[model samples]
Target: MREVDLDVFASELAEGAFAIDVREPDEYRAGHVPGVRTAPLSELGAHLPALPADRPVYVICASGNRSAWAAERLEAVGVRAVSVAGGTSGWARTGRPIVDGTDARSA
Candidate 1:
């Protein structure tokens, strides 16, 4: 699976890149990157059809591990996916904005 730093992810996001939060629902509810869809790692398969395959998808989790796993799974299915290096934790540490609660879709 390909990987990208949070900054690159952020820039891509700004350009309308698709992103998925592979963390569990609860963890997602606590916080997540703005505009990211909540598709927990456990339910990735079910949501695959809903994800965009034409563009790069940023897969992220609490740390980088889960995102890496998710990215590999997505790539195996022909989706252009990339793991967010350092994941959400790194995003937060770098002072990136986060949204809480459900229904936090991109504006």
Candidate 2:
């Protein structure tokens, strides 16, 4: 699976790339990159069909492990996906903006 650093991910995000947090709901509620939608790794299969095949999807998790797996799964199904190395923790550590809540958005 392809992997990208937080800087690259953030750049793409600014350009309107789609991103999904594969962490669980509670974990996501704790904090996440702003505007990223929730799609817990547990329910990823149900979300696969809706993902865009034409654009790269950025997948993130607490540290990167879950996002790696999620990225592979997405690619296996023909969706172009990239795992965000360092994940949300890295994004927060870099002083990037984060949104805390259920977000109420869908991808």
Would you estimate the TM-scores of all the predictions? 0.93, 0.95
Relative to the unseen true structure, what is the C-alpha lDDT of residue 32 in candidate 1, on a scale of 0 to 100? 90
| Per-residue lDDT of 78 in model 2 | 87
Write candidate 1's Cα lDDT for 37-86 as tens digits: 88888888888888886788889999899999889988999999999999
Query: Model 2 lDDT vs. the true structure?
Result: 0.89
Top lDDT hit: 2
CA lDDT of every candidate: 0.87, 0.89
What is the lDDT, from 0 to 100, of the residue 91 in candidate 1?
95
lDDT of candidate 2 over 10-106, digit per residue (tens) = 9999999999999998888899899798888989988887788888999999899999999998888888999999999999999998888767455
Q: Which stretches of candidate 1 lie over 4 Å from their true place?
A: 105-107
RMSD of each: 2.1, 1.0
Candidate 2 Cα errors over 4 Å, as ranges: none
